[model samples]
Each structure stands twice: as C-alpha cells, then as structure tokens.
Target chain A: MSFSKEITIAKSSVPKVALLVLATIFAFGIFEVGFDQGQLFSIVFGEQAYADLYIHELTHDMRHAAGFPCH
Target chain B: MSLFITIILLSGCSAGVIHGLVNLALVEPYLDKAIGIENQHMFASGEAKDTSQFWAEYYSYRAWQKGGQLLAGAILGTAIGALFGIVFGYAKNILPGNSFAKKALALAAIMWITLYLIPFAKYPANPPTVGDPETILLRQMLYVSFIAISGFGALGFYQVFRRLKSKRFVAVLGYAGFIATVFVVMPQNPDAITAPADLVNGFRAVSLVGVSAFWLSVGLIFGVLWQKLQPDRVKQARFQ
Candidate 1:
C-alpha cells in the first residue's frame, strides 16, 4: 500500500445559509467561553437593566480551567 | 468513526474537568483565605459584605459552577480535540510505530508551554477584584493576542525546520533567532500588581496546576483512545 494518503479540501456539501448559521454558532461559542466574561450576550442585547451573576460566576471557573486568566 | 472520535474527546475532557475540580477543592481554602484578606478592608468599611455570609454564598455558587465548568469543558474539548485528533491521525502516518502516545504527550507539552506558560509569565491572570471593569476587554484581548502569536510562532518553527531538513544547523539558528525576536517584540503589560503577593501567588499556583492537569489528561486519554480504536493506523505507521 502507498504511504501517502490523498487529502483534499472540498467545497461545501451543505447549503450556504446552513454553513453561515453554523459558523455564527461557533463564533458565539468561542465568545462565550473565551471573551465574554459572561456578559457578552447581555451587553449585545442591551440588557443592562438586569444583572445575571450566574453566568459570570460559572464561566469564571471555566476561564481559569482554560488558563484564560480569570483572576 | 467521527462520532467515536467525538465521544473519545468528550471523555478526555471529562477527565480533565474532574482533575481540575479536585485541584480546586484542594486549593479552595487557601484561595478563600486570600480573597478574604485582600478584601478585609472592604468588609470592615462596609464596602463588601461579611466574610461568613460571603463564604456561604460563594460555596453555594461554586457547587453550581461545577456543573457549568464540566459542560463548558466538554464542549470546548470536543471542538478543539476533534481538530487535534484529525491532525494527529494524519501525523500517525509519518511517525514511527508504537510512539503515538509519546508524540501526543510531546505535542501537549509544547502546547502547554506556548499556549499558557509563555503568555501567562508575561501577564498572569488576576482575580475578579484586581483590575478595572472597563479594562477587562483590553486585558483579555492582549492575553489572547499573545497566545495567538506564540501558537503561530511554534507552528512556523516546525514548518521552517521541515523546509531546511538538509541544513539542521541553519534551521536551529533560524528558530532560535525567530524565538528571540518574538521575546523582544512581544508587548509587555506595565500595570503594577496591586493585589496581595500571597493571594496572587496562591491563585497563580492553583491555576497553573489546574490547567496543567487538564492538558496532560487530555493528551494521554486521547492518545490511548486513538491507539486502541484504530490499531490499523498504528500498524500502517510502523511500515511508513
């Protein structure tokens, strides 16, 4: 058998809209885990009137776990 | 097979989360004490709540936070680990036989150094009370940019090494030069450390331990799983 395996980058097998949606979800996930400090969603949605400490506290451990510097 | 890979990655992440939680439990008292000391003035001046009441609320919050951390770890691990698994699977073709775990561990070590240690040495993680709330975004951006630069720099070094396989001496010099330049050019945070020294040291120790445990567990578990699930790949690797 040959040692080298052929590798190729294929065009989208799924619809453009679906891919876009998936990309958006991935980006949001990254933001929530990495950048948000738990307030990104609320800030984006203009929910300044309400305080949600739960998400922040929950993600605090995660930030430390991922070494994102949650101090 | 893809689903199997995802499951394996998730399991590895679960192990990582368990290790992290245990480390947190071991270090929790010291951390609580540090936080209390750092904020004692606030409590005394009525700026912060009482320590007893705070601990009660904090422990309860942490009990729930455990579940969130596990979920987040699972999601993040599966996403990143899937990509890692694919690349490692391909790399198996080029490596010697029965060395998958060793190679994986090597990669994990490098990742730990470049991704966390280097950036962290420059700008250590501060606790919730350390910095201005407004500057949180800027601090996070700076830290992440450091991680990105280190990661790409490591990858570039590997590429350069491969391209100059005929001249090992030149490759070594080139890599050293590149790394030195990165160290010189990487921006430094000039902010003074205002937190108590012991508190900062305790937090840094625990945080590093937790992250190191997670990465080590992920690498070992994933490597073993991949080896067992795809023995044929290993056999092929031996001949190559």
Candidate 2:
C-alpha cells in the first residue's frame, strides 16, 4: 500500500479517538511525572515498561470509549 | 505554519490506525505466548508465593485476559510518540527552544529508565532468607520491562516520524485505537491477580526504582522512535 493509505489504514483516528488519547496521555503523564512517585500504590518498579504499559492500556481504554472497533 | 501542522497531524492519525491493525493481526499471538509462560510459572509454584514479589517467581508474569493490553499499549504509544515529535518539530521552526513534546518524551523516557529499569530488590513478608525473593523479582521485572521499553520505543518513535502525512489527532488516537484492537482480538487474560508476598510489608525502595526506571525507558524509546520516523510530508509541513 502507498504510505498515505497505509498510515490512514494503520493509524487513522476519529475526533473522539483524539480526545480520548489526549485525555489518557495527560492522565498518564500527570500520574507518571507526579503522583506515581509517592509511597502509595503507584510505584515505578519498571518505569518505562510500566509507563509504556500504562500509556498502552490507557489508550486501549480510551479507544473503547471512542467507539473504535477493537482488534 | 498552521497549514503545515494540519497535514502532519493527519499523517499521525493514519499512522495510529495502521499501528492498531498491525498489532491486532501480527502481535496478538506473541502476547498469548508471554501469557503462557507466566501461567506456567504461577501454576508450578506450590508454596503460595507473594503475588507482590513484582516479577516471576520462576520467570513469568501475566493476567487472565487476552493479550489485549499489550496490543493496546503498542498502538496507542505509536500514535502519541509521533504527535509529540511533530509538535516539537513544528515548534522548532516557529521559535527557539520550542520543542515541547519532543523534550517531554525524552525527559520522560530517561526518567523512566533511571527510576525503574535498574536491578532492584523486593523483600519477602516473612523471609527465611533462603530463596532470596528479591533477586527473583528483579529478574522477572527486567524481563517484563524489556517488552515495554523496546516495544514502546520503536513504536512511539515510528509514529513521530509519520506525523507529516496525516491528522495530528490520528497519532493521538492510535494509542487508544491499537489498544482497542488488542482488547477485541486477544483470546485470554494474563494476570493472576493475587498479591505478591514481597508487598506484605511494602514495596521496598530498590524494587520500586526498578519499576519506575523501566516505564521511563519505555516512554523514552517510544517517544524518540516516533519522532525519528516522521514522513517527509511532515518535515515539509513543519518547515513551512
């Protein structure tokens, strides 16, 4: 497929999708950069890995909220 | 400048969608495989080990749900990384030291790696000091971290590079989009859900460090990779 087509097919996001991602990333960023460091349940044992996972999962949840078709 | 940014964002969204599809089709099975290892370890261990130990007692960790989480993470991260890169690029042209998103990703990644990815400890609730649970936890944590750090890094960076051709929100959308794909496609859950014995007292400083560092690295890798992978369209737009 052409680059545009591939990108469109691979990474297209609706307005809702964008909003969800923005929301989740902001939450994730706030948590990771701020509160996660505290002694509560938010531990950064596997920093990038978990942050990466959090971002990933947050996206997943956000996607579901956005009415996107799941894999 | 506004015209240029609009195209880059479009490219980013397209990249996100593509990433989701790819994860659903190609990467779901591997998640299942990772789950298998985690399951096997949990099953074989009879002593009722602490769930909070942080890593595999033998060498695995997982959930009962399908490999949806990993897929979701992959797709979503790819998009975010791309968006961040493009925004940074755009800012560079507009003003001096204006690379906001790019800086955020880099700082976040490095912070994650340093805080969570290091060799660390997890103390057992009631240690006979025989098995040295801390050591085991460290190894397992490392293994799990490997997946996120490399996966996020590569995927995140790739998205950044694609921002020139598509919608800005597309990359942002991809983070959730790919995750949605994984949630629907995966066949099983990977978590055991029991508390680890190590956490009986609390998450020791060493172990927590490992956790933070791992995620930090994950963010960084994905962030940078996305930045580097932008399409020429994005570059042209950013310069415009």
Name the top TM-score candidate.
1
Q: RMSD (Cα, Å) of candidate 1?
A: 6.2
What TM-score does prediction 2 earn? 0.28
User: Against the true structure, whose DockQ is highest?
Assistant: 1
Model 1 chain B: lowest-lDDT 10 consecutive positions: B230-239
On lDDT, the leading prediction is: 1
Compute the DockQ of candidate 2.
Answer: 0.04
Off by over 4 Å in 1: A1-30, A38-50, B1-4, B38-41, B49-59, B66-69, B94-97, B167-173, B231-240
Interface RMSD of 2: 15.0
lDDT tens digits, residues A1-71, model 1? 44645332222132344334434544555556566643665665456513665456666556654656443
How much does each candidate deviate from the true structure in C-alpha RMSD?
A: 6.2, 17.8
lDDT of 2 by residue, B143-214 (tens): 334334434643574456456465655654564455345334433222222434433123233223323333
Worst 10 residues of 2 chain B by lDDT: B119-128
